[model samples]
Target: MSVKTKLRAPSTVLVLLALCLLVSVFAISGGEYQMTPWQVLKVLFGQGEGIENMVIWQWRMPRAVAALLFGAALALSGAVFQSLTRNPLGSPDIIGFSTGAYTGALITLTVLGGGFVATSLGALTGGLLTALLVYLLAWRNGTAGFRLILVGIGISSVLASFNHFLVLRAELDVAMAAAVWGAGTLNGLTWQSVTPVGILVVLVSALLLANSSQLRMLQLGDDLCRALGMRVERTKLLLVVLAVFLVAAVTSLAGPIAFVALVAPQIARRLAGSAGLQLVPTALVGALLLASSDLLAQRLFAPVQLPVGVVTVCFGGLYLIYLLNRRTTKV
Candidate 1:
């Protein structure tokens, strides 16, 4: 008789990383002129022909990489907020920060008319301001997750109207361009724009890493966290700032990618079999999700090439409905 043993599977984070890398390979291989995954790997390792190298290294690589990074950033931000608020629905999209960022962008496109730098600055400034507003409004001695969400919803509604007004008032050409960007397409992404985003991702990730312990402490309820010597309000403020920075940066670049922030953390929580959202697995899930969405956006409609946001919304909307049906508690 032979004895047989079953081995345990890999860690959820590792599995997600592997999946993310696999999706990225296919992402680089896709686009107008397709290539094989083997060819993409060769080009990645500095082999392949000039045109192949140009296509893989120069063109598609930046967009693919950006999608991965931005996805991770959004998920990390979402994890921070959800854990901080102890709310399943805590996300930038729900919290009005993304809409506020878009409002700033509309102002930049219409009023400043300045170039990329000014617009980026405008978006960042706008989101941070909105975060502050939400925090202040939600605070009645201390912020509760439910109050915060309600305030955010109200603010987002107001901003959406303002955003439309700005777009309608702008020149037709500029309005058209802004609309496309607002849709969150990765088309025409180049290394020049991607470099700064990459740097921002690194810096923000480091900040999150350093504050990770505090984040865990915060999750254990504010009174308990305070009793354990955590400066509850200060930590909350700092984490909120970091979260807003992430959402704003992604919105500035990719136009508030839908559902990556909202969905990834919750999904990762289940996959990792954890009661709370874990950052590492969540980030990987986010990377895989956004990359997969971008790939689908490219090929699903073929030459038409829908914006990445459209696919995310289509899929995310379904998830939202299912979540609602579950009757999950807000906090």
Candidate 2:
């Protein structure tokens, strides 16, 4: 790498990290019961009074942290998938994993009337199953990026239809609850609810970082990777499993919050001016995007907060349009 590129990359990542911290602080401080930065710091240090401390620690802090972690997981997952597939559109949400997760959650809610734990297990099962199916179908001689993406899109559409059917057949209250969950709000999340997911994200992210060299190798094409003594298929499978785990964990916790996985990696690549994926920068960008979006969802309409997923979908839809337009122009 060039000396200029090295310096520029680290600076960009640092800026993204700083932006994430700023957004997180804003999220903690700018809720319905507003607190200044001083009050937030006091609450963090256990110096604030009862209500302020409860509000910051019990409510906003957990939600903000969950958003950050979920975004990072999704972003890193997207980077891995995009690298594997060699397609900009390769992401969990677009490829069927998120829809599959929603299907699982819908079944738990509508059929079993399950609680949080059961619903989360169901979502994880659904997402993994969908991923396996896509992998199996996409394996011709071996998995090809374009073929995998096409098969995933088809499976995603089928799962989405089934999800709608499940929702429609459910009782009014159950359907309403399922619908709300599917929209992916971070409301009412406590530390207890987010703790397991936080741990999973941390562990999985560490593993991904450890395998970053393999990931970079795989991006160099299968023949080149094999010539370099990399087990191409094994590396691909491992990365795909890791990406699936990240997606399932976040979907279980937050009901498949969309678009971060699809957009954050591309944004990071562009910002860093890197030909290859930059996992850490992608994660930081995801954290900043989701944290800021969550803040906007809360404060945009005082008394009537929007779902974080809603805001992200709006932004992602526009991005999708832009990508399609740009692709068409190139073609």
lDDT of 1 by residue, 25-49 (tens): 9878877798999998898888899
Instruction: Kindly report which residue stretches of model 2 are placed more than 4 angstroms away from their true locations once superposed.
Output: 45-47
Per-model root-mean-square deviation over C-alphas: 3.5, 1.4
- Measured with C-alpha atoms, the lDDT of residue 215 in candidate 1 is 93
Off by over 4 Å in 1: 1-10, 328-331
**Candidate 2: deviation at residue 3, Å?**
2.7
By summed lDDT, the worst window of 10 consecutive residues in model 2 runs over 37-46
- What is the C-alpha local distance difference test score of candidate 2? 0.88
Model 2 C-alpha lDDT per residue in residues 61-177, reported as the tens digit of each score = 889899899999999999999999999999999998888888887888799988889988888888888988999999997899999999999999999899889989999988887
Q: What TM-score should be assigned to candidate 2?
A: 0.96
Task: Kindly state the number of residue pairs that clash in model 2.
Answer: 0
